[model samples]
Each structure stands twice: as C-alpha cells, then as structure tokens.
Target: MNGDWLTRGRDGRLSVYQLSGEAVRCRAERAPGGPWTAPRQVGGDQRLHPFLALGQGADGYVHLVSWRPTVKGEAGLVHSTHFRPRLAALDWNPVGHPDKKGDRTGPPAVAVDAQGRAHVFVRNKAGGVSMLAQKEKGGWDPWRDLGGEDVHDGLAAVTGESGRIELYAAVPGGVLHWRQEEPGARPVRQEPLRAPVRPGTLYALATSADRTTLFHTGTEGELCAWRPGDKPVTLLDSAGHGPVSAVRCELDGHDCTLLAQRSASGRVAFAAYPTEQESAGAWWTESGPRLTVDARVCLATDEDGRVVAATLSPSTGQLLLTRRKDEPGLALEAWREV
Candidate 1:
C-alpha cells in the first residue's frame, strides 16, 4: 500500500523509495535525467513485508512512513522520519512513535504542508481512522481519532492551496471523506461519498490536478474514476484484475493525465485525457507493457513531462526503475527498466 513512492524535491532531485528487504531504502538522482545514487538504507525496524508512504514537504524535506500490517515494525512501533532531499544520507531526523500506544492497522498516508508540518493518516485494527501530525520543530503529536468505521486500507491525503487538507478512505457503502480547512481548525465534514468499488486497493489520482479524482479496480475488474460530478466513470472494456497508478505528462502540446494499469498478464497500459479538447466525456486506454510477476508497480513524474515508474522486483525486493516516452497517437514505447 504505497501512497507515493517517488517524489520530486524542490531542488529538482528525483528520490525513489521502496520497502527493500528488512528496511526501507531510497535512491536519488541529482536532477531530472540525472544519474541515481546507490540505494541507501534510510531507516526502519528490521521487518519483512511492511507498507510505506512518502511525501516531500514545502521545505524540500522528504517524509517517510513505515508501518506493519499485523504488528508495527521490528521494534514493535510505527515510525516516521524526515531528511534533507539531497543530503539525506548524511543525516536523518527521526520523528518516532506515531501513536503513543503504538496502535495501527495498516500502512499510513502522509502529506506535508506549506509550513513544513507533516500529516499522517491511517486506519487502526478497529477500522477507525487516526492521524498524527508533526510540525517543523516539535516532535510528533499524540494520535487523534478521526471517527469512522470499517474503513478499508489505502488512506489518501492531500494539502490544498488555502491550507485545506483532505483525506478519504473507503467505507462499507461509499467513501468516508474529511477535511480541515485551516490549521488548528477541526474537520468540517466526515461523511461518505457513495460508491463501493474495489476493496483494499484505494488509489487517489495523486496525478490529477485537484486530487479529487480517484481510480481503483472495480469488483468485476473494471477501472473506475470520479465522474465530472458524482457518478463514477468506468474506463475501457478490457479491465481485469490489476494495480492502478497515474502520472501527469504532456504529449504533443496536450497536457494529460497518464493512467497506468496492469493487465491480467502483468503488462501495464496507458490512456490520456483531452484527446481532442472537447470530444465529450470519453476516456479510452491503450496497451503499454507487462511486468514480471515478482514486481509491484509505482509511477512518478520527472516533473519535466517524462513518465517514470519503479517496479519492486522480488529478485532482490528493490525498485527496478523505468522511463517511458510517448509516441504519436498516445501509444507508448516498451517500458525500459532503468
């Protein structure tokens, strides 16, 4: 359950992270299309098969979250850390103990705001949501319960222009939504925005402009996104069981959202928006390439329009990074693993 495994720092560095072996590690390039440094262990308890969330604050600090499914990390705790985007290997500022009682249910989602505060949201074993925040200077605050029930995992969070932070997760009947308009302000609403799609894999289109659009595999393997208004937009006719992710890129002067999905064969594919600027509300998909069975996919943008992805291969349980360029007619070349 990785929220965003690849983040672009303010300094133009591209940092790639993944759950490697018993700990989480990161690899970075000095700038776009730059050479990447060797993978370096940032920090985490010695444990296997843990989940992670990653975000970069306005201050160019990369925030990391490492938590377990059944228990916390090896030290039996959910932990977090922050470090300079470029000099991360030289130093790490640990913001430990997400919950005082160390209670957790699944991997956490993180978002850092303009004031350099880190916000984390996660669902506990009881299916209630809890959040922990850490400001620029102070340590992590105590966990606060944001009441909701039976919320599925894969919580998503985003910060808005006016200090607004939004979080959403799947509930029994629909999505449970919450918002904090400003700092120190309580959540304005906590209710479900009806629609039950796939369970366990809730993906926020972090690649979308408003972050309001979400995509997940439907119960019957159909891919779904937020319709222009309330209804969900089902894209394509070949949807099958797969993983979903997206990246914002421009192709032939058309700024578009590149949607990636793995087919039953493990091949990833693509689709775009605004194909003709006013062709009605139609979204179509095209085949890309498949991945080996041992890999779980994650996508990122180089921020310069180059689409990048990193697949975690079980061979070494490390990221196998790839870069793809768009071809005419929205078709994509084979993903070249870097």
Candidate 2:
C-alpha cells in the first residue's frame, strides 16, 4: 500500500519517495532499521513509468526501463532504456551504457535476477513481443522473439523459488509465457492463455510464490487466474469498461492477490483474494475487504509480504504511497504514505 514506495528488495533494502512528485525520488536503505537516506532522483528528465527499481543481486546497481517521446526517422517513437543505480552526487549515471535505438510505445517490463542481469520485455510495432537481456559478463543480448504477433501492453517477470526465470505478456488475443533454464539460454513458450471473450485486454501478470500459477486482467474488468493444467478461471468480475492491473504476493504469511481495474466512471477499485488451499488447488478466494485507490498507479511486492503501489493523485499529479497494516490471514497488506 505505500503506493509511493518506488522499489523494494527481498533483502529489505528499499528505494522510496524523496523529491518532486512528478519525478522519482528514491533512497536505498535497509528496511526495519532505516533512517532512510536523503532521497535522490534516479531517472533524470525521463519521467519513468511505474514499477522501475533497483534490481536484486547486484550491490548499488539499479535497473530502470522507461518510454520517452522521441523522433525516429521522420516518425515518432517511444524509446526505452535501462539505468544503473548511483548516488545523487554522481548524477545517476547508467551502468551498462546501452544504445538508445528502440521503440517503446508498448508497455516495457524489466527484471533483474540475483546476478544483476537485466531482462527487458517489449512489444514492437510488428505486434511481436521481444526480449533483451544483459548478462554481467556479456553486453545486451540481441532482441529475441517472444510470441504473439500483435500489440502487447502488459508484461511481468519474476524469479521463481527454483531460480528459473518466468515471463508473462498480455498480447492482443491472450497471454503468453516464457521460461528459461539459465541465463543466455533459449526461452520456451508455453501455450497461450486466452483472455475472456469480453471486450477487455490483459494488462498485468503476477505469479504465486511457487511460480506455477498466474493472475491477469484487462479492459474487460475481470481478474482471472491460470495454472499449469486448468483453463483460466475468473476470480473477480467488474461491470466497468476499463482495463484491470494486478499484483500478487504473499501477505501475512499466506498467498495474497490484488486486482485493480478502472470503472466506467474512471475510478480505480482493487480487490484482494487470499489463498484458500494449502497446496496447489483450483482457485484463490476473496478474503479481506476491497479497497479503492487512485486510478493511475502501479503495484509491486517485497519479501516480507508487503505490497508497494504507485498512484498519481489526479488532484495534484503528485505520487502517493498507501501502506496497509499487516495482519494474519490477510493475503495482501496495503502500504500507507506516511
């Protein structure tokens, strides 16, 4: 719920709010023991998209991906890039020095593993999803095709408990998965997880702790889940007319899921579902009270069963973080912007 908590790590180091609301103000410090350092700007004038953060596995190195307006060969393009985490006095220099020659109108998702490697997922104009990863030893690898030969909007990635990497993309017709055994290896595509036949699109994908199940939603205002063997099941359905963005994590020591979707009136409402099964089962159940927050926001999770959400208050255009009190049996805890 600290909607403003920019990025958090499993080790309890958090880079959180510090400066002008329009830009990202982040500071790195140990959680549960912090006198958080002075906040610093990570993305210069870039105006980063939601969910940017310092990747896990590397010390003092952060990875950022953003879509900025640009002119490309007489046409307009949105360029995305990755930056390294540095001190404010150092002016936030980019770590890997990657070339800025790509399109970014589509949503681009980034993930950094335990080795400080950078993995990027973006949908190109050709309607195909492409991935670019940077290894500590090698530079940026060539862009590889991810499936779905159509426009894709939402992308999510996570490192599983087994250390294998999994990626989810919301493509034109449905959702797709990519799994890799190790770094620099080819990713194998799982079957397409089709979205509902309603008039919505899949916007986000989050996995359970085991990484075997996935949760997703789209413009149709429905929250659904997909496991390895079963068909996608609708968890929460909304009569509204906008897309739904979702985040999943453990809350209060139990599996928790959060689904946020825009209503017909443009207000964003979030629903929470708690894990009902002790082992892998059919579906997650709604446990706690539903909460609504600012519409234009993003969500993330930390290791301690805490949820970090980013939302811009339309009244002020300033970013805010909502921190929820932690409680047992609760699947998700909101962070307040205290």
Candidate 3:
C-alpha cells in the first residue's frame, strides 16, 4: 500500500514523506511549491503502512512513526502492529531500527509542544492509547500507556492553555482526554468530552489565546465540533469527507482556524473559521481549490500557516503532493500540479 504524508520543520521547509510499496520516498523544500530537493527512498517492505505520522521536535529533527501490518501464517499476526519509528533531520536522514515491537489499531497522530518536545500518540494493541516522547537530543521514552479502553481510531494532541499538552482518543461512548498537568504529575488526568463523538480520528486545537475547539467525524460521518462546556455542533453532513483538521491561523489580525477535508471522490477542500466572536460557521465553506486523488489521507498547515495535502493514487499506487495555485485566499486558490 502507498502512503502520502506532509509536515513542516523548524526551518519553515515543507517535508513530504510518500510510501510506495516497501520504499519510503522523501522530499523537502524551503517552502511548499519551492524548489524541492531530489527525492530519496528509505528501505522497507510492503508490509509497512504508508500512512505514517510525523512531527518536528524542538531540537529541530523530524520524527515519524508507522507500524508494520500483520502477516498471515505468523504466530502473533492477529495481535501484532510491529512499530519501527524513525527520527530524521531536516534533510530526511533517518536514525532508528527498521523493526520494533508494538501494535497500533489506527493511523498515528503526532504534535510538537511549546517546549519543542515531540509528543506522539497511537492506539495500542488493547485499543488503548499509547504514547512516546522524544528526548531532547534523540531516542524515545518507552511507549507509555495513556489508558482508554475501546479507543476507536485516530489520535490527536494539543498544547493546552496552561502549556500542558493534552492527548485525545475516541471511545464508543465519548471522546477521551488525557494529559499531565505538570512535569511530574501523579496520574495522567483523564476526562470525558462534553458530548458523544464518532469512532474515527479525533482532532483538537487549542489556540494561543486560550480558546479550544474539538472536532471529529460523527457516527453518521458528519463533521462535528464542540467548544468546551458546550453541546456538540454539527458543522456539515457527510458527503464522503474524512480526516478533518483545524489549524491555528490568523485572519484580520485575529487568531483563526483553517480546516480541510478529503471527500471520498479524492477531491480535497478547505474552509476558514474565523474567531468565535466573528462567526459561528465557516467564513467561506469548501470554496478552496481542490486536488483529485485516489484517497487523500493527510492534510497539514505549516509554520507559515499555508495548508498542505497529500493523497494516494489508486491507479499507480503512489503518493503525490497536492499544491495550490498562488492565489489570494486560503481555500480559494486553484490547485497547481507539481
């Protein structure tokens, strides 16, 4: 299976990682649409999934994690996820073993905190959340259990108002929140989200201004968001859109949220949610330029607040970068083929 993923480093370069069968291909640029470096392949086998999770550490290294799929006729195939995580510099040079023991039930998600520390979370073998923190220099702390039973799918994390990084998981009943308030907090605080959430990936964003928004794909596949202490709000009914994301941005000198989604038809779209004081909905809904694909899995915004995307091609089974035309608006730009 092929995978396509995008992330930004401290240097403001857009780093793209594409998985084709067993090889991982990488390319980076000072910025999206800039002169991309020559692509290079990292060794691996087809058993590995291409939908890798990526984050940039405060130390200036790119961190990635994806587990190998279970193979039939193997002793632990039914209970295996075999994770071999990697850490790379801005240049895409990797440092890690190709095979590590672990299991993951969903696509991984990662985030970097204010301290430049990299925090990664994934659903583990027991359908519970497992996390690993990258040390200042290199190496990862042993995967720690961030307990949650029946944790359905995707994982998300955000640096909270108090500068504490909180991780989220979707369980059958509601969204689960986990966090350690301080450096040596006793037990990781766990709480229930205000409302019921779908079993897909959970997305959370905490603005620097102290506003937090929680969004997810509902049981009916509709996009939903809820503010803390409030009822869940349905943003849009599903029409094959999956993998929702909200990134911190600026509009008219105020902090905003930039959202993106991939429709089942392979068309990727974007919308803008200005400050809560400004509106209750997207300023311009799904009006951005779109990229056609076999499946769009990853959508991210870089340090410059520009949205970037990637997708899988059913025909060629390769991952491709989705770029936008140099137009004025965030979602209004037309797509430019690279």
Candidate 4:
C-alpha cells in the first residue's frame, strides 16, 4: 500500500487501494474525513503481485493496473476501474504479457490521458521498457516497446496540466524521460537527463500546466529535483529511503507542494514548500508512530483541499489516516486508524 496507492476522484471522494494477501482491497471516503467505508475486496484472490498502480482520468474513473502470474508462471498486467466513489469496482481485465514468450515483467505503472486512454508501462524482461495503451474507439492497442535499457523496476508516469503523459525511470548515472508532444499521442523519449537518482525512488509532480518536476532520493539519499534541461536541485537534504509521494495544492490561498516519504527509521516524514520554488527551501518533519513493519506513505489533497496522507500499520495491518489542519504551514492532525 505504497507508491501512488491513494487517489482522489473528481467527485471529491478519495479511494485507497492496497494488496491484502493476494486480493486487492479498497477503502472509500465519503468526503475527506470521517465515515470511511470498511475495506472491500476488489477482485477474487489470485496470484497477483504486491504492487498496485492507481490513476484517475478526467472522466472521474480511477484506473488500476497490477501484475499477476499468468500462463507459464510469468506475470501479466490486469486492469480495473472504479467508476465512482461508492460504486463497486469493475471486474479485473487481463492484459497479456508484453511479448509472446510470456516474459516476466515488473510491476506496472499507469497514466490515463485526456482522451481517457490508460497507458500502462512496465520494465520488460530484457531490462528495457514496454507499454500497452487503450485505444480511443474501444479496445487496446498492441503492446509497444518503449526502448530503454539499464533502467530500474519502478516507473513513474503522470499526465501533465496540458493533458500529455510524461514518464521517468531511474537509470545508472541519471534518469530517462519520455513525454507526449501532444495530448493522447505516444510519449517520445527525451534526451537522457542527469541525476544520480536511486532507482525505485523516482516520483513526478506536475507543478504547472506545461511543467513536470521529477523528485527522487539521490545516490547519497538527498532529495533531489529536476525538470527538463534544468540542473538537479536538492529539495531536501535527506528524503529517507523510498519513493517520495507529492501533490500540489493551494495552501492558505498560496500554491504549494507537499511531500511524504518513509524515513530511514521507517517513520513517515513530511515537507512543504512553495510550488516550483526549490530554492525557497524545505525541511523534513517526522510524524506518526514509527512503523513496526515496512510501509510507505501516500499524499493527496482531500475534497476540502486539505492534504491527506495514509499508510498501512505493518504490525496490525490496519489503515491509518491523517490530514493537514486548517491553520498554517502544513500542520497535520494526529494519525488515527480508520
């Protein structure tokens, strides 16, 4: 239940998905805070991977993509959609392996374009990347190979303010990027960007209409930022050990960006700064009881425009929720199990 597991729908209702055993479970918030529905099983139990990728389209539907063992014991992607906050999720739809050999692939990352097509990306068996996207008319287009070798497993994909999809993957010396020149078009690979990022820590934030900033833990654990053609900027001195969850929202009428990550000691750490103003500075503040087991924190803006963060209790396996208080400077309410 980490890495983009929480999604807020256009209706203002928030949906959180997590892997419980081999089955996917979903919890819904009527609005931002209280009276969240009890966890409901998404699909039948299967040999599904532990990862789940959640993406919301402009149409208000939340699209999910996950890997599950298919024929020959190789993993294939499965797709599902929750049309509305309180509605039952659609049945799992199978997206076969990228190649005919049923090659084993890594967990899939998804982004739905303005045209409502879901683009799924995964690290292929050959150490490169492959993508399978939905077609406008109805069905899905065949899997297309988006070439990149020496990349890591976790793929970060997001739709920009202009409705184009952009992707970032961490490689050895730097990061690889791809962006759609136009909305609903194939994402073309851009020049290899420079950043000594630790793989699996890459996250993308659409700070403005035409701009997306990539954030990741540097090879030395520093939280770093890089937009196309710009030199890498250190957002925080230390971002801890995993992928950073970020969201841009209006904080007290001023635009701001919020970040959350798992601290090195396994506690949830948070930071805030003015959007696109990396030089303004940000400091990490640790909160919540340190997890007794491994877990990650996810950030999203609630219906009330307050920042909402959630994570699983590794010891009890219960969901914990917290929200930013109305007052100044990213103050969050106490963490309470929901």
Candidate 5:
C-alpha cells in the first residue's frame, strides 16, 4: 500500500512527494495522474498551517481546510475550498463561518460517498463537531452538529462499503461514533463506545475492514480495540512512552492492526496485532523496524495496501518518508528525507 505525502513548502506553496522504493521523490505538480498544478493556497496569508488534504469525488473535486492563529494563539479559519478539475485556473475559497465567537476550528476531514457527494468534518475549540456536505446537485448544505453538546478532542470521517458514512471522535471521557445511511442524515445515532481507563489523552481512532470494530490509543501509551459484541480490549500498553501517534489501515489479507507510537524517549515505533483479538486477549506484537527520528510520525496507506510513514527530522525539522517493504511480515524500506 504505497501512498504519497503532501505538505506546505518553505515558500508557503503546497508540495507533493511520491513515496516509492523507500525514497520520496518530489513531484513537480500534484501526484502523477493528478492535477497539473498543486492545490492553490486557500487564504492570502502564506503563514497558515496545512492540516490535511482530502481527495475529491468522482466529479474531480478535491477539498481542503486550514487555519491561521490569532495573536493570542487561537486558531481561526482562514480558508476552505473545493477544487474542480474543470476550474484548472481557479483558487480555493473559505467555506461558511461555522465557528462561534471565540472558538477556532481544526483542519477538516473530507469524505466522498458513492454518489460523488463530499462530506467534511470539522472540530471547533468549543468542543463541538460539525458536518458539511456538497450534494450531487452542486449545492453546499448547512453545517450540522454531530458531537452532541460535549467537548471533543479529535474528529475522523470515513465512507463505509455501502457508501454509508461513519464519523468518530475522541471526547472528554471516552470515544464517540456515529453513522448515517447518507452523507447528511442526522447521524442516525451517536454512542460513547470506548472509555480509556488509564490517565492520558486519546490521540487517534480508526476502524477495521468491516467498520464494526474500532481501535484507539490514549496518552497513557495504551492501545485499545472495541467491537459490537465484545468488550473494549487493551491490545498494547505503552508502559510510559505515551499514546500511539499514528495507525494505518488493515494489512491486505490479514486481520491485523498496524500502528506507530511515540516511545518514552520520543522515538517512533511500529506495532502490529491481529484484528479479531481483544486488547488483553492478544499480546500486542511489535512488527517492522523502529524509526529513531526526532519528531512524531504520521501514517498513510494507499489503495494498493502500501504503507508510508512520515515524520519531521528532530535535527533539521525536515519531513521524512519511509516506505515499508511489500512483504507478508513487517519489512520496511529505507528512510528518506523529503
């Protein structure tokens, strides 16, 4: 499962780099077979932080959201836009004003359903979560609340097999998940399914192939998995290194989980576990090579089942991408600085 990396260049321009053969090669424009020009800057301020870029639907539209911090360090929405291939000469624009008076919104998570409708999830400083969607008719819908009235830490959105939408979040006390039949159904229902008993913050949450099982990691350095008919299991306890920073998709033809965690000394380590076992049932096994980089790592998987691990160099702060070898076991490609 090879994937590409996208980040803002030193000059404030969006840059694309392809991860292949354990090396990252810069693509002059976007990824090959992608738009010729990289995504345009959404806001005037080049100092804005680049959160994440979401792929467009079959209609050839890509979506992105980013923010700029205020004088006091509060993030404010700067721009959110939909890129259409037809509008090659166009630039991104800010979406609706979804944040409240003093609340700031986080980077948006984009999801494109089977119908080619775009669904975006945004988190606010007020602990609220909102969902915005673009219908097939080419109209932007109103922002709808999904977090209920609680404070949420992080938000994630994914499209299921039947094009159903699943939204997950880490709230103050536990994790919450909601699903809908369509892009804009009132979330159908919301439930707090997993509670991290240890002392730590929940950093990330991901689902298995069936989307029936959910996995999460907390600040206490423990990894947990939850399923419909089973109790929440602790797959791995970090001891004290801190929570798992990143998790990739399920490996091809295996019921296993792959995750990247920050150690006590801040080094990043990769671990894999069987998907069907409980956290306590199956001993969390560490697979692949350990990366001793300075900064935290992020995990991305391509459609073909390749995994790309990325982190910033602690010494120079330059981004690094490592491609794991395409083997049955955990074999990693060489690490290269992008």
Candidate 6:
C-alpha cells in the first residue's frame, strides 16, 4: 500500500501493486484502461516491511524491491521481477545486507537503466548509501558503497536522459546526490543540494529525457521543487507530511507535470503545470475525499497515455484509482475502487 504501486507494461496493461500481509499482490487491467483483474499474490514473506519500490525498464519488465528483517533480526532487501503483464513475479531473492553483521537497513529505492538493468539503492545501517546493480548479461554485482554519511531513509533514484542512474537521499541540513557520467558507468557522488527536506518525502520525476526534477515537503511545511544546480523552489505552503507523487506527460496537447499529495486537511490535492517551470506557478486543487494526513498518493501514466492517480482507502484499505478526463486541463474522472 505504498506510493510506488502502479506501473504499465509493454503490452499496454496497467498493473497496480500492493503489499498485504507481508506478501506483494498485483491487480492488472484486462486491457488498456479496462476492467482490473482480481488480486494475485506475487512475492514476499512475513519478514517484509510494508514498503515496496517499483520500476519498469524500456523492455517493459517490472522490478520490485522491499525491505525485510532477516532471521538474525537485521534488515535485509529482497527483489522480484515481473517479466510480462499477466505472468507471476519471479521468486523473491535476497539482495543481501551490506554488513555481514546484518546491521539493520532502510527502505530501498530502485530505477531501471535503458539497457533494462535495475539499480537498487538503500540506506545502510551506518547512515550511508549502498548500491547493487543488475549485470548486463545476467546476475547481480556485489553490493557497492556509494558513500554518504548522516543520511536518512527514504532514498530516491531515477534514470537520467542519458540512461544513467541517479540517486538522492535526505541528509541533516541538505540532500546528497549521485549521478552516472554515462550510461553503464559507475555513479559518482555529486555536490549535495542544501535544503531542509523532510525525510521519507523525497520523490523524483524524470521530467525530460535527461533532466529530473525532485518534489518533496520542506521542513518548514511547504512543498518544494528542486533540480540539481538550482535553488529549491517552493510550490505549496502546506503539503501535509508524507511523500509527493509526480508524473510527466502531455495534457491538453501541452507537455506538463502532474503532482498529487495529501493536504493538511487530510485530503488528496492535485496540481499541474509546465514541466520544470516551477516559477510560473502551480495551483493545487483538492481531489476526492479526505484521507489520513499521512496517506500516500501516487501518479503514473497509463498505457493509453493518460494520467492515473491511486491511493488506499482509509476504512477498507481498498485501492482507489482515478484517471485524467479526456476533455480539459487537469480534470480527472471520479474515483473508482479497483
């Protein structure tokens, strides 16, 4: 029931993933924007945390990762792959703890490169960043330390326009970042951006082929948008306390970025604006009924090139989804329980 729960595959089928009873389950559309199928268990065990990180590559394979406590009571990471639209996920495989002593780890963040390899990142027990990457041929490389100290959990990773992976984590007084100079090359640490970002609220959107813009709630209780080498710009004053979900697509025949987040009143709010043009301003409009103040809202593009927003119901925990209406600017269809 995390924010990163929706994805679309190569065959134009949209899949919604959820974590229930420590097992990952999926409900996919029978066709693009069609009726959704029944829930099917995909992977996970009792040790799994409620968090799930999902990423899809150019080849349409969906990669999912989550944190689990090992038998030794130390935090560990497990990974699974969905090769096709309707196929069951591959068995959950341990990504292994960076520390042999099995020191507890944090939730994982993942991104798939252009070549279809999924790169996984997590906060190590020592408050630093560690990475494990999928090999070009097959198999995974040994866990490598990307190096950052005093870092918080809730890491964010995205594939850049050049197909290289970039990583970001919230630190005490600012944000730490890592970027690959070229596709398939090692990602090296970059200059950290100074901002008082709320931990567990770091979310990234690849606004363009090569550029990415980050959206998060600031420590001062405002929503901020930031790009590397640019100052953090405030987007909203009271964006609640959790993560902000964003997706980039064309709206009303114009390129735009759509964002969804819980408001201070415990309601999900939606906003749209020109991509990467935060200074032009964005207007936040309340959508759907009030949710818990901490509820997570997710935005993703469906197979039919329409925007979709998904969130969990407070009473029933059912997955509720709404789609962008065909007529106008930033309008959405009524919320439907899937």
Candidate 3 regions off by >4 Å? 1-4, 30-33, 42-51, 58-60, 68-107, 160-163, 183-187, 209-211, 264-266, 276-279, 283-293, 297-331
Best by lDDT: 4
Candidate 6 lDDT (Cα, 0 to 1): 0.81
- List residue ranges in candidate 6 displaced over 4 A: 1-3, 44-47, 101-103
Give per-model CA RMSD. 3.9, 6.0, 5.8, 1.8, 7.1, 1.9
lDDT of 3 by residue, 1-338 (tens): 21125666556676666666544566677454476666555433334554566554444454555555554421111101111112232322222221234333566666666565666666666777766665657655555777778877666766565555677777776887776657423128455774556665466767544546777777776677756556667776543544565566555555667666665544655566664532366632443233455455456665556566655454464455554434555533444334
lDDT ranking from best to worst? 4, 6, 1, 3, 5, 2
Residue pairs with backbone atoms closer than 3 Å in model 1 (clashes)? 267-290, 268-289
TM-score of each: 0.81, 0.66, 0.73, 0.94, 0.68, 0.94
Q: In model 4, which range of ten residues has the least summed lDDT? A: 98-107
Task: Candidate 4: give the clashing pairs.
Answer: none
Candidate 2 Cα errors over 4 Å, as ranges = 1-5, 9-13, 16-39, 43-61, 68-86, 89-105, 197-212, 218-220, 238-255, 258-294, 297-310, 322-338
TM-score of 3: 0.73
lDDT of 6 by residue, 1-338 (tens): 32367788888888877777677788899988889899888863445777788887878888998877766656677889998768888988887876654755677788999999989887777789888899999889888888899888788898776677888899998899899988777789988888787888888878776778877778788889889888889986755667778888898888888888878777788888889888878878988877754456788888778898988643455677898888877788998778
Candidate 4's displacement at residue 163, Å, is 0.7
lDDT of 4 by residue, 1-338 (tens): 32477888777888888777777888898765658898887855556777788787888788888777776656677888888878888888888877755646677788888888889888877788888899889779888888999878778898888878989988898889999997667789998887577888888888987999988888777888888878889876674777888999888788989888878777888888999899999998899887755676888887778889998754467778898899977788999988
Ranking by TM-score: 4, 6, 1, 3, 5, 2
**Predictions in order: lDDT:** 0.62, 0.50, 0.55, 0.81, 0.51, 0.81
TM-score of decoy 4: 0.94
